[model samples]
Each structure stands twice: as structure tokens, then as C-alpha cells.
Target: MAASGDGISKSDQLDSSPSSPSPASDCAFSSSQSSYMSNAPDPRPDIPSPLENGSMKHHVNGDSGVNGINGQMKATKVGSRSWVGIYESFLMKNASQIASVESTLQHLTYLFPAKFKDAEIASEVVYSALGILGLYHDTILARALSSCPSSAKYQPSLHTRYTRHFTTRNSAYRTIAYMLVVIQKTELLNEIMSRRHGGQRGQHTAILGIESIKATCRLALLRISGTRTLVTPPIPERDIDPNVLDQDGPITHAEAAEEDGDYWMMPRTGQKMPQLKGETDVTRFLMKKVLLPDDVAPSPKLIRPLTTADGRIKEILYILRPLVYALLALLAARLRASKRFKGHYEKVVINWMPWVVGFALEYVCRDGIIDSLSAEGGIRAALTKITGLEKRELEKRSNSMWWWTLRGQFYDSITKPILDKMIKKAENIPLLNLVGLYITDYQYLAETYHFSTSTL
Candidate 1:
């Protein structure tokens, strides 16, 4: 921004005029060539000696200095271009990896969702959000991580804002959520809020109210037009036998449970060892605790009946079950950023409650995850990923599950506190202290940016 004594700014230093180099360029050239005169060169008969001809010496020195300056300028230009190219290449690679991870997670949710968690729908809209003129995912991510320490530039991104927009909620909820997450860093969302509602907190309250109603109406329409209870095909347990990963031939599956026994996962023996259940170590314990297997590891049934009731029973509660839960989910999704809640208790509740409720609903219906290998990724998924068409249906089916993690409350509340204590203890250790620093940065990133916090 500002430059010292000579008054040439950073921009001028990088792109100075050819005839007049900046002070930095001049100083660099001087220091680099300071040894030039002392270095010995082979004597040439045609060259005039400085001692014999003073004017000839000045002429040669002046020409040599001009040529060197011109060369330095040319090299700087080339280097700048090269640097930009490298930066872009790395950015695209990161985006691709992000998309891939999101896709995998979404499918995994459908196939092997957390004990209580429902399968994630097509939620890969992130990759599509890229290519925006001034927006970059990494830049937004950096801002999010930095904001956790202070909410000075932060805004509670509520789901109500975009839920009314059918195409967007279906496609770009994550991107839109992400855009809101980094509202302060990139002024686009800020400008939008200001333009629409006079930029006042009070002014926007009415919009939220209106949006809440619209969202309720939309969900009502979906419920009325849809089935009374959520139903899906049962999910299988194991994808393939781990022992088969070491083999070189096609594996066999039980003919009776062909669809339930296998999945589309690659069998790689590299960098992996069998997970022994006998180990008492923390790592093994954590690996077991992190994932819980499905309740019924039953053989695949061709036609599973999810509903058991034969009809009748005109009960109010039963009739309103979908609406009540759907509304509660909307409320949870919209309430956090309202500033009315004094604590993040609601956040933790939203993160896990719907999941628990989902486990029950699916349990009663006898339906689990519906299988689909091909699904289009959403904007979040693409930036975060890209899923399949049927994949979108999975996300739709995931409705009513507490997706409170969208704002990343669990990481900040539960994971952060634990990791913070661990990092502090690690801070005093030898090699562990170095690892602490990396984890600390990553912790902040995960806290700030909830894009990777998938609904799956």
C-alpha cells in the first residue's frame, strides 16, 4: 500500500516504466552487479583499456547498465505471469479435490450414514459456484476461519433466505450458505441485504418473518403432494469383503443378497491394514465410536414394505406429524442467526436431534437409504462437489433431519473445546507442538467455514 522514503508504492515496484526503474529495482541491480567489475575477464585486443581511454570506459559502462535494467524488467514480467499460472493450477486442483470429497461423503451418507444421521441428498453446488469474477473458495474459507475469534465481520446465515427459491434450494443452498458465511469478506451478500432491506437489522426482521411463512408453505405443499411417511429402500452393510482388497481377481457375491452385499468402492490394499477389534488403543476405540453399523444387517429384500399400518385411525397428531417436524426443522434452520438465543445450546440440539428422529422414522417405516450410484452434485457439492440426479432425490428424502451443522456449531462447541485442550497439552511437547500449530489452523478453518459440514 504505502512505500518508504522514495515514495514508489508496491504496484509501481512491480510494473515500473522501462525508462525509470523504481528505487528497489535500482538497488537490486546495483547489489547484484557490485562484483561485476572485480571479476576477471579474458583480455581482448579489440577492447579499449579503461586506464588508456576514460571516455570509452564510461560509454561501455552506461550501455551495460541500461541493458541489464531492461533484462531485469523483462524477467520480472515473465515471472509474474508464471506465478499467476501456478496459482490457478493449484486452485483448480484444490477445487477438484473438494468436489471429490463432497461426492464421496454424500454417497456414504446414503449408504453408511452415521448411526442416527440420514443419507445426504445431492448437495454439490460448490464446484458450480466457482468462476465467479472476484470470488474464490479459499479466500472465503480464510475469512471464515479468522472470524471465529470475533463476529465483527460475521453474520448468522439462516436457511430461510434461500428456502423460498425452489431452484436455488434444490441446487445452490450450500453456495448461498457459503456466500452468507463470508458476507463480511466478500461484500456481495452485504450489498444484497442492504439494497433489499435498508441494511438495518430491524428492517431485515420482517423479511425473515415473510420468508419463514413462504418456506412453511412450500414444505406444506411438498408434504401434501407427497406420501404421509418418508420411505426408502434398505441400505446394505458391508460394500465388499476387506480380504478381497488384496486379491487380483473379480470377487463373488452371495446370489441371494447381491445388491446388499456389494458397492462401488475401490478395493485398495495399499496403505491399509486390517482393523483389529481387540486393540485397546485410543485410535482403534475412536475408529469404532465414530461409525455405528446399521441396526439390522439383514439380507437384501427385493420388495421391502416400509409402512405397517393397514389404514383407518383419524388422529390429529398423526396427520400433523410431517408438518410439525418439517416446521420445527425450518425453525431450527432459521433461528440461529437471529441473535435472540444467548447460547449455542440450540445449535447442538439442531445438529443431532433430527438425526435421532430420522433414525426412528426410518426404523418404523422399515426403509433405510435408497441406493443410487449416479447423482449430480450441487453447487456446494461441486465447489464442495458434484452429485447425480437421483442423488438430489436422496437429499430431498433427507428432509427433517437436523442439518444444524450447516453453520458448524458442533465443531465449535464440542470438537473445538476438546481439540483446544489437546493442542494446549501438545504445545509443550516436542514434535507434537509442531503438529499442534497445523491442527490449530485447520480447527479455525473448520470452525469458520461450514461448507464441508455436509447434510449427508
Candidate 2:
């Protein structure tokens, strides 16, 4: 917030000053110089002429303009740093909620074990999601470990279980989310490259063009045709030639010295393929399942609409987004209510109530006929806890399993089918087509509903 050393911030100056002068203003002579040459009366004798005095140094050689730009750049850097700090702090503060969401999501991944065809594939999906989210790495692990409670309820075994689940799921959910984002980015890259090249393909434009996408599809097929594991040639240790290195020092190997740049390089029988930018092994695995090219017909065996494992996994996460938000909101409410924190009641209600309501609505939709039965069971439990007279009797008589059975049936018969249909429908639309529709819809809605009614 400090001044830009020109007496005021560039932002303040821009706001306070008039619009910049027209180009014609550069051709005009100084009024004072013109008056002096014409022998006209001095407009103000008391005023020091800018040409004689150094007070107008700001105007000399466009130094003011340069200073303004520099100030703006500095302000931008400061703003970026502040924004990053705020985002990191937000992530840290919500680590527990994030951990819970991830744990639940991983458990949900188990629900679709059949969808993945095997336990290993389902586990792969889970791990892929984790890797994408950076949870597989130490990035979120430290935060999660620090935020967990060190109370009696969280015994060593319980803590270990919690940490294990947190690490596994947090990364998995993040991975799935990141893959969706990457799909959009890659699609955009493809479009831009195609527009620039107008169909004629070259190596540089290949990644962003149709050729790259076709190459990816072909690569995916080659991968699917073989076992998932890559077979590398075994390196045999041999006595190094003393002449290989003249001095007793570490030496770079010839193979290590070659920096591979072409990501689209096809895998040869005994050679390794160059790694794709912004991709992990897990990410690459998932992308191979669904990445389709504009020119090629999508393979029936590959992921289509909602039929493929990747599509189903992504869709499941999409449907669960509301639950994630609900969990976060509830966690935030607990944080706000804790003795250490202070916040407005209005804010708590404003931020928390909608999530609570949405969660309730979703629960009702999911449970259908079972919602009332579950509510009844919850109320009965609460009453028994308060009375304490028939706690043992109530526990013995509780029909929780009956309610759960009904809920399960509702999910299997109604909710799951509807979600499956929706996922399938989504698959019919190309990824790029979906993105374009979303952007167009967003723009239309913003223009129609915005206070300014901006057409842009």
C-alpha cells in the first residue's frame, strides 16, 4: 500500500487524472515558450516556469510514463504475492475438511468396483486421482498431519488409519479434478494449433493440431494392446573402461546427456518415449483411456460418454462435488464456533445455511422414501440420548439396518440409474463441444443477469 515514490500510487494517479492527451498534443509547443517568442504578457509572473525550474522533472523525457509502468508492475507483483499467500492460508485452514472429503471420495470409489472391471483398475483410478491432486506427494500430507486432532479418540491406530485414508483419497480426488482441467486445456491447445496451421501439420504444431491427437489415440491403442506395464531393457553392469573418464571424477553418461524434447515421439522396441508436459505416469494412464481426436472415430473399447472407466470416475466425482462443498461448509461452521475464532453470526448463517439446505435436498433425492425413515431413526436416537432411561432398550430395538436397506435400494434402483444415464449423455458430447457450450451459456447468463448487463 506504500506510495509509488512519485508522491502517489500509479492507480491513484490514473483514477484522479484526466484521460491521456491525444497524439496531436505531442506536436504542440509549450504555451510559455510560445508566449515568450510572441512577446505576449506572462500569464502568471509569480509562477516558476517548468522549463527554467527542475520541478517538472516528471515530464522530462517521458520519465513519468516509465515510472507509472514500473509502479504498475510492482503493484501487480505485490498483488500476486498477497493472492498466493491468501490461497495457501485458505488451504491450510481447511485441511481437515479437505481430508474428510478425500477420505469419503476414496470410499465412494470402492462403490464402483464393478464399473472398473477389477479391484486393481479401481485402485488405479483412486491412485490416479491422488497423484493428480499432489496428495501422493508431501504437498498436502504435511498440512493434513498437522491439522489432525491429538486426542484420546484419535489413538495411534486411529490416527494411522485416518492418515492413510487422507493421503490416498485426497490425492485421488485432486487427480480426477486436475485431469478434467487438463482435458480442457489440451483441447484448447489443439484448437489453437489447428487454426494456425489450417490442417497442414508439422512437428511444432503437431501437439496442438489434429496430428498430435491422432498420435495420442494411436499411442493409446498400442498401450491397450499390451499389458499395462512397460518393459525396459535390462542394463548390465560391466567394468568401465579406465579411458572412459581420464580423471577420477563423476562423468555424465552419453544416454543421460541427450535431452529429449519431442513429446509425440513414438515408443520404439527398446527405446523410451519422451514424457508429456504437465503429465504424470498416472495422468498419462487415465488420458489414454478417453482422449479422442477430431479426425478419428472413437474406439468402442475406449471410454465413451459415460461407459469408460475414466468417464464414469469423472462423472462420479462431478456428482459428489455438492457433497464436498457441504462437508467444507459444515467444517467451516465448526471452525467459526470454536472458542479460538471470532466471526459474524450473519456470515456463518449466510455461508453455512445454503450448504446445509443443499445437502438435505440431495440426501432426500438420494434416499427418497428412506429419508423420513432415516430422520425418524435419528430423532429417536437423539431422544433416547437425552432421556437416558431407555438407552439400552432403544439401542436393542433400533431398526437402523432396515432404514439403511431402504436407502441402499433407493440408490440402486433410482439414484444410480439416473446418474448413469446423465453420465452416458455427457459422453455423447465431445469434450471440446461441452466446453464451448459451457462458455457460451456462461456468457449469455452473465450478460442477461449481470447488474451492468454487459454484452461482452
Candidate 3:
């Protein structure tokens, strides 16, 4: 066949057209024919080929090499999806569960010995669960505190319940104390106080709330004194029954005279008792003169209670007035000395003036300083001269500038209103002592160094 210009090669025509039979099909046909001609058993096993098995092993080992890079791409896509689902389901739902957990804690409180027995275990479980769930919150803690009774019904058997199951017993006591003082929960606190007197385990638990108990007592006393009405139960007086004799019988006049001696008699035999010589002896002598017996009878001296108001006032003034006068005199002298020295002394005095004033006022008022001044008198004097220096030092030590900032907040929130009303209504009544009570309370707070600026 001579080649024409068209050429028309059979292989070229087959490759270009869809109607052509494939080479792969021809090869399969040929292999089948060869197998048929051999008539021998096929050599290939029914098990996977060595090449196929090797490819699977590479996939299992997470190897892209040999298996090709496409397999690793498939795996990374699957893993990323799983991680995203887990994070969303666990971490994102935590905020919604906190309230439910807090409610569970409150409900658990009422269950008695059963819960008490495994209280610590229960607490651990709860905390662990909450942490795992990521639901722990401050509101849960505050809710627990507010709901727990300041004075629960006194049940001796429930002592174990409180001791064991109350997870934050100390914090609970402190919170209750703060609330009672803040809210003035007198009746509830009184019940707590009465329960305290029963000498039971429940009371012991309640006594953990001691500040509340004390505040209740003080408020009751003040109310009674202000009203002059015995509305509240009387504070129990310590009884000294005459029939209850000492081991040596009732304190005898002769024995008392021997032990305490006759201060005014000037020693019957003029044999000066060595003991009756000092300032203490002089004080005893003066007391004897003022408290002389009316009759010759040497029976035990009965001390008369002061009946006259003037006499009580005079006694108080006698004890306090001299100290006040001395302090005032000292302050006046310092002022006068500062005036004489003028510029330098003025600066020195000014630097120490606050402390000097603070100390002098504290001495006169019998109050402790908020910040303890240096014991070295000179340094204290120097520091006190600067205005507000004492207060600044106190703020520094206590780390509470809020005290200075919120100076009158407690009074404004609580004391001042009550005092103004009491003053307006009970002007005739001697309620000045109530002011003294406030002063005493303030002094106590200062002495304890509890100047909580946040509280103010």
C-alpha cells in the first residue's frame, strides 16, 4: 500500500475516535487466553497483595510518604472537626450551670446526719464537679452566705450538721456578724445570745458569731438606758448569796481589818504598820474618812449606793477632770512655746502638731490613736506638727485611703440619724452616755486596726 497524502493510519484513527476498542481490554483478553491455554492453577492468592498490605500499613502509621500526601489531608480535616465539637459542648455551657449548683448546695444544708456523715466528701465532690463544669462563681458563695440562718432553730443533734456540712463555717460566722451589725438585727441576735447561755453544742456553733452577739448586747443595753423601760430582759447580775459562805466563813471585820487594815485609826498602839505608809495608804485613809460608820457597832461596813445624781456626776468629774485639765495645760504650754520660737519652732510644731493634738485629745478623751506614734517623744512631736500627717500615716499603715475618703459614711448610714432622733426626742433624758458608747466603739475599732475603707 503506497502512502497517500491523507495517510489515514488505523492506530491514529482509533486514538482520535470514541468508537475504537481500548488497549486495556485487548490486554485482558490476551491474558485470559494465556491462562486458559496453561490450564494450571492461578498463582495469585485470595489474600491482599503485598503492595496493597504495605499501603494500608502506611495509612495506619499516619505516614504520607509511600501512601502519597492525599491521605494526611483527609485525616487532618476529620480531627479538626472533632476538636471543635468538644470545645463548644463542654466549655461554652459552663455559665448556665452555676445557679443550679448553688441551689443544690442550699438544699443539701437541711439534710441532717446522712449528709453530715459524708460532708467533707460531699464538699469535695461538689467543688470538683463545679470546677470540672467550669461553673464556679462568687454569686454562688454570696447566695450560700445570705440564705444560711443567723440564728437557726437550736437543735443539739444538728450540731454535727453545722460542724461538718457547713463548708464555709468561719466565713459564714463573719458574714452573719457583719450583717447583724449592719442591719441591726437585735431580736434575732438576742435569740442567738440566749441560745449561747444554754451551754449546748448548737450555742457553741452560734458563739462563732460572737461579734453579732456583742453588738446585740450593746444595742439592748443602750435601748434600755435610753427608754428607761425594762423592755428587754435584764442583764444577769453576778449573784453573791450571803448564805454561800467561804471556806473560812463570811469575810470577818477583824480579818478584813487585818488584811485591809484601819487606815483612819492611826494605829491603835501607835506602832506604825509598815504597809500604811505609801500613796496607796494615804488613799485608803481618805476613803475611810469619807466612809466612816455612823454607829459604834463594828459589824461589816455596808457600802451605800450613790442615790443623788449630783454625787454620781461629782465622782466622775473628780476622776476625769484632773486628767483633762493636765492635758489642756500641756497643750497650752506647747502652743505658747511655739509662739515664742516663731518661724523654725512654728515649722517644727506644725510638723508635729497633728500628732500632738491627736495624742492630747486621745489622752483627754481616753482613746487610742488610730496609728501608733513613735514612742520616742521627740519624733512624735515632730511628725504631729504637719496637718493630716497622723491620718496619712494611719492610712499608709492600714493601706486604706477609703477610710479618709469615706470618713463619715458609717455615721451617715447608721449612727447620726439614730442619734439625732434620740437627741431630739429624749433631750430631757441623760443620753449623753450614748455618745460615749459611740466613742468607745470607735476607739475599739481603731485599737483593733480594723479601719476597712471598703466597709465605710
Candidate 3 has an lDDT of: 0.33
Whole-model Cα lDDT per candidate?
Answer: 0.34, 0.34, 0.33
* Cα lDDT of model 2 by residue, 120-199, tens digit: 34443464465345332234333222232211111122112222332244554334333333442233333333434564
Which structure among the candidates has the greatest TM-score?
1
* TM-score per candidate: 0.24, 0.18, 0.16
| Cα misplacement distance, residue 75 of candidate 1 (Å) | 44
- What TM-score would candidate 3 get against the native? 0.16
Worst 10 residues of 3 by lDDT: 229-238
| lDDT value for model 1 | 0.34
Error of 3 at 366 (Å): 11
- What lDDT tens digits, residue by residue, belong to model 3 across residues 354-417? 3344333323322112111222344466355322322332344344222332222344445555
| Candidate 1, 282-301: lDDT as tens digits | 35334333311111111111
> Which whole-number lDDT from 0 to 100 does residue 5 have in model 2?
24
* Cα displacement (Å) at residue 166, model 3: 38
Candidate 2 deviates by what RMSD?
31.3
